[model samples]
Target: MDYKYIEQLIERYFACETTLQEEQILRSFFSQGNVPSNLSEYADLFRYESSESNIHLGEEFDARMMELVERKSGMKNKVVSIRGKFTPLFKAAAIVAIVLTIGNAAEQSIGNRPSEGFDDVTAINPYIKKDNISAAIKVKDNTQAETKTVVKSDSLLIENND
Candidate 1:
C-alpha cells in the first residue's frame, strides 16, 4: 500500500538516472491491476511496454522490408535519352547563336549610316585639308579665265589681218 518507492523510481526514470533493475521494478509494479486511482494514468503506459516487448518480427518481415526498399530504388532510377541529357546545352548554344546574330546585324546597320555632326568630305577622307581644297579650286578658275582671254585675242587678231 506504500507506493512511495514506486513514485521515487518513476521520478528517477523520468530523470534518466534509474538503473535497468529499477526500471523493471517500476514496470512490474504498474503491470498489476490493483493500481490506485492516482497511479492509474501510468498503468496503461507500462502495460503497453510489456505487451510490445513480447512482440517479434516474423521471418517474412525482412523480405517485405527489402521488397519495399527495392521498389523505392527502382522508382528512383529513370530512363533518360541522349537528347534529354543534352537538351539544356542545346538550348544555351541556340540562345548564344541568336544573340550573336542580332549583335552582328545591329553593328552593320549602325556602321552603314552617314556620320552625323561632321563634314561629309572629312568623314570620307580624314587626311584632306580645307585650305588645300580652296587653293585647288582657285587654280582651276584662273586657268579657265586665261584660256577664254587667249581665244578672244586670237579671233580679234585674225579679223584685223583679214
Candidate 2:
C-alpha cells in the first residue's frame, strides 16, 4: 500500500547501500502489475528482469556458441603460427644488422689510416733517394762514436788530476 519503503530501497540501491533482501523485495514488489501510478515508471524495469530470468538457452544455442568458439580458436592458432613463421626472418635480420655494424666499424677504423712504418723516409717524401737512408745511418754512428771518445778523454783528464 505504501510506496515510501520502495522509494527508500531504490535510493539505497542507487547509493549501493541496500542489502540483497531489500533489492529482492523491491524487485518482487515492482514485478506485480498493480504498482501505483507514481511507481509505474519502474515497473517495466523490474518486470523485464523477471521475464529475462525465465529465459533458458537450449542445445541449439550451445551448438551455435561452440561453432563460433571453434572458428575463433582456429583463427587464433593461424595468427600465432603466422608470427612463428616470421621468427626466422627476424633472426636473419638481426644477424645481418650485427654483421653490418661490425663491418662498418672495421671500415671506419681502416679508413684514413697512414701507410706502413717509415723504415724508409722516402715513403714520406718520395723525392728523397733510396741511397740517402744508408748515408744518414752512417753519419749517426760516426757522431755517437765521437761523443764516446770525448767522454773517454774527460775520464782520462779526471784520472790525471787524481
Candidate 3:
C-alpha cells in the first residue's frame, strides 16, 4: 500500500485537520510492526494507543473501587455520627463534664467568701506600697517603649542585611 496518503494524514493530524476516520487509519497503519523507516517515530505513539484500547479492567475492579469509596465514607461518618456505636460513651462523657463543672463551681464559692484580719496573700508583703508599685509600673512602661524602638531598629537592620 502507498504510504503517501498516510503521510498526508499524519501531516493533517499535526495540523489538527484530520477527521476521526483518517486518525483511525493512521493508528491502524502505524500499529503494524512493518513501518517504513521515515514514519517509525510515529509508530510507538499509535502502538501505545492500540495497547491502551485493548486494556480491560479485571472482573473485581468495580467492586474493589466501590469498597474503597464506601470505606472512606464510613470513616467520615464516624466523626459526626451521634447515634452510632459510640453514642452511649459520648453521653457519659458529657454527663461527667457537666458534673465536674458544677462541682468546681460549688468548691470555688465555698472558698471565696471574704474574711477579715489580713487573710489574703497581699497583706503579708509590707514593701508593696501603692506609690512604689505605681513607680515600678511607670518604669516598666518606659522600658516597653524603649523595647518597641529597639525592635523597630532591629527590623530595619534585618531588612538591610537581607
Candidate 4:
C-alpha cells in the first residue's frame, strides 16, 4: 500500500499542524511495523507516543495520594472540633468577667458610702435659733398662769358659800 498520505501527515505532525486525531492515526499506522525505509526516522516518535499512552500512576501512588487527602480532611475536622468545643467556654468566661465587674462596682459603691448615719436628719434641721426657744418658754409660762388663776377663783367662791 502507498504511504504517501501517511508521510504527508507525518510531515504536518512535525510542523505542529496536525490535530490530535491525525497524530493518533500516524501513531497507529507506525505501530504496525510496516513503515518504509525513508519513514524509519519517525518510528521512534510514534513508539514514544505509544509508551506514553501506556504510562500510568501505579497503585502505590494512588494510595499515597488518598492518604494525603485523608490526613488533610482529618486536620480540618480537628480544627472545627477545637473551635466548636472552646466557643462555649469563651462565652462563659466573658459572662463571668462581666458579672465580676458589676459585683466589684457594687461593692465599691457600698463601701464608699458616708459613715455618718444621721447626716441626712441633721441636714433637715440645720440650726436651733435662740428666739424659737424663748417663744416656746413663754407659751409654757402663760399656760401655768392661767391654771393658777382658775384654782384661786374656785377657792374664793367656796369660802364665801361656807
Candidate 5:
C-alpha cells in the first residue's frame, strides 16, 4: 500500500491544485480507512466530501419553496380582491354624485324662472292687433289716474228756526 501518490495528491488538494479526477481518487482512498496515523486528520475531510456529494435537497425543500411562492402570489390575490370589492362602491358613489348635481341644477333653473307672465303670449300669436297694442300700452300708463271725493262731517249740528 504505497500512499506516496495519495500524499502527493493531498498536498495538491491543500494547495488547490488537484484536478477533479485526482480529488475523486483521494476521497476513495481515504473512505477505506487504511490511512496512516499522520494522514488520519485529512481522512475526515475527504469522507465529508463523499458524504456531501451523496446528499441532495429532498422533496420537502421543493415543497417549502413552492409554498413560499404561493404565499407571495396569494398576497397579490388578496389585494386584487380588496380592490374589486371597493370598485363598485366607488362607481356607485360617482353616479350618485352626478345624479345629485344634475338634480340640483334642474332645481336651480326652475327656481330662477321669470316672474312676468306675458313672456309666452307672443309665442302663441306673432301678429299684434292695434286695439290690443293700445290696451297693452294703456295698462302700463293707468297708474297715474287722479280722483277727488268730499265727505260730510257729523260733529257740527245746526238748529233750524221756523
Candidate 6:
C-alpha cells in the first residue's frame, strides 16, 4: 500500500500545518485497524482525538450546574440593614469626638495652670545669679543719682553767673 500521502499528512499535522480536512483524513486513516507498521506509532494519538470528539455534556448538565449555583448563592444573599452598614463609621466618629474632647480639656487645663518653670528665669538659666543682677541694678541707680547731682550743680553755677 502506498502510505506516502499518509506519511506527509502526519508530518504536516505534527508541524501544525494540517487543515481540519487533512486532520479528519488522518483520524479516518488511523481509525481503520490496517494502518502500516511504520506509521503505527501515531495511531493511538489520532484514535484518542476521535474518541474525545465523540464526548459531550448530558442534557442535565446545565440544570445541575444552575442548581448548585443557586444553592451556594442562597447562603451568600445575607441582608444588611442601613444601620448595620453605617455602624463602623458611627463608632469611628464617636471615638474621634471623644479623643478630641479629651485632648481639648487637657490642653485647657494645662494652659490655665501657672507655668512656674517658664516664669522664673533663674530656674532656666544657671549662669545668671541673683547677686549679679542686684549689683547691675545698684550700678544703674548710682549712675542716675550722680547724673541728678551734676545737673543740680550746673544749675546753681548758671544762676550765680547770671
For all predicted structures, in order, the TM-scores are 0.36, 0.37, 0.39, 0.64, 0.47, 0.39
For candidate 4, lDDT tens digit of each residue in 31-82? Answer: 8867899999889889888988898989999999999999999999999999
Q: Rate the local accuracy (lDDT) of all candidates.
A: 0.86, 0.86, 0.86, 0.87, 0.82, 0.88
Candidate with top TM-score is 4
Q: In terms of TM-score, which candidate is stronger, 1 or 2? A: 2
Q: Write the per-residue lDDT of candidate 3 for residues 40-136, one digit (tens) a residue.
A: 9999998898789988999799999999999999988877684677889989999999999999999999778775543343455766777776777
lDDT for model 6 comes to 0.88
Q: Candidate 4, 60: how far from true, in Å?
A: 0.9
What is the C-alpha RMSD, rounded to one decimal, of candidate 4? 11.8
TM-score of 6: 0.39
Could you tell me the C-alpha RMSD of candidate 1 in Å?
A: 12.5
On lDDT, the leading prediction is 6
Q: Where does candidate 1 have its weakest 10-residue lDDT segment?
A: 74-83
lDDT of 1 by residue, 46-154 (tens): 8898889999899799899999999887666533455678899999999999999999999999878866633656768888998877777799999999999999999
lDDT of 5 by residue, 1-162 (tens): 677998899999999999999999998998995789989999999999899988889999999999999999999999999999999999999999999999999999986776564444554465756578678768765643321111122222222221
CA shift of 65, model 4, Å: 1.6
Model 3 ranges with Cα > 4 A deviation: 65-162
lDDT, residue 148, model 4? 99
Q: Point out the worst 10-residue segment of candidate 6 by lDDT.
A: 115-124
What tens-digit string does per-residue lDDT give for candidate 6 at 1-162? 899999999999999999999999999999999988999989999999999989989879989999999977765654345567889999999999999999999999976765563235565576787787778779999999999999999999999999
Candidate 3 colliding pairs: none
- For all candidates, the clash counts are 0, 0, 0, 0, 0, 0
| Off by more than 4 A, model 4 | 114-162
